[model samples]
Target: MTGTVLVTYGTTNGSTARIAETIEDVLRKAGLTTEVLAARAVASVEPYDAVVVGGGLYAGRWQKDARRFVRRHSRALAERPVWFFSSGPLDASASERDIPPVPAVRRAMTRLGVREHITFGGCLEDGARGRMAGMILRSGKGGDFRDFAAIEAWAAHVADELGRA
Candidate 1:
């Protein structure tokens, strides 16, 4: 397909945004037109042929901006090829195995007929915001756990699927 893809994401400390950019890069490299934007900054999905939405997981829920974005654009998203991803596992679990979406994301996916969903490891560092983040850092759990190789593979898969569609 020769259509543009929008890669939008909600991030707390920017790791999820990085993942979204990574996806955008792969799609572009595969000859697909693409744009990467923060989830909250997206005014509409009507301009894109396909979309990939991602959020940083916190307390078992997607970042507020992501949830709001989905709710706001449900109708448009339902009519298009949409994929979902979550980033927020300050450990190796996400990289080590398949981490399913939280319940709310699952419901949204089913409701919107999302093409696929994935969970990638998250990153938290010294300057991350939030009290909980500070606590996690103090407790020695903060680190960058995102597996770029896995992220690239997933993006490649998305590009392939989009081509077939």
Candidate 2:
């Protein structure tokens, strides 16, 4: 079925927005109609056939808006194909391996029946606009650890699933 795909995201310093846009681009290239929107801009889920929600992680949690989006629309979301992704943990160092979603967020996803959930390395820059936040992020560790290939692959999978449904 040909239908609208909503790519909604929350980002602290725009990395997650970039990821959301890239997913939208991948879906568009695969002949799907897509709309990329900030989570706060989404007043309702009425227009979408499927949804992909993404956000950056901070202090071991998904962005607040993202969690609120799913929590507020859980029932409507349960009726559609939905995917969740988190951007955090800058690299694949031993310390960053297998970092899972936070407990409350994981429980919410389970309650909402989210089709898929992924955690990928996020980026932290030295002199970016959110310089203070970036500095704090770097005080412990820092890197641009996103894997575009994996992101694209996941987008492809979402497209395939949408095509099937």
Candidate 3:
């Protein structure tokens, strides 16, 4: 039912944080008390009833802070409702494509007992990426490719599912 939800993320240039913010809106609207924070800043999950984590994908990997967050809290996370996501993929229609899991995420999910993970369309704005990432992002593929509608829908679904908690 309605309870406290923690929505935290790790982002390189803030895109994944934005996703976490949007998810917070959806969850709050669905009657849950929600808070958003950075993965590294989250000191504990003892105050939360559910947890949602997301991160930016770089070089086929999720943010280190996020991975560490999982490793550090796997036991607690496994005892609650948890969901994971990765935000990267320059294709404008990438949300429609299949989401292949990163090896680290696979282990994290297994350890945390989470079954569903999403790969959302990511945003790549100028001056927001590292040198090499900027190069790849600037290769005629950079833009705000995030599918907000899909993201909102996913958030709504999560809220509904958590309502049973």
Compared with the true structure, all predictions reach lDDT values of: 0.96, 0.83, 0.86
State, as a TM-score between 0 and 1, how close model 1 is to the true structure: 0.99
Model 3: per-residue lDDT, tens digit, 36-84? 9999998988888889999889889998888878877887889889998
Clashing residue pairs in candidate 1 are none
Candidate 3 collision pairs: 1-163
Candidates' TM-scores?
Answer: 0.99, 0.89, 0.94
**lDDT tens per residue, model 2, 41-126:** 89999889899999788777788888788878889898888898888777774134655677776887788788887777788776
Candidate 2 global CA lDDT score: 0.83
- How do the residues 50-70 of candidate 1 rate in per-residue lDDT, one tens digit apiece? 999999999999999999999
Better of 1 and 3 by lDDT: 1
Off by over 4 Å in 1: none
Residue 75 displacement in candidate 1 (angstroms): 0.2
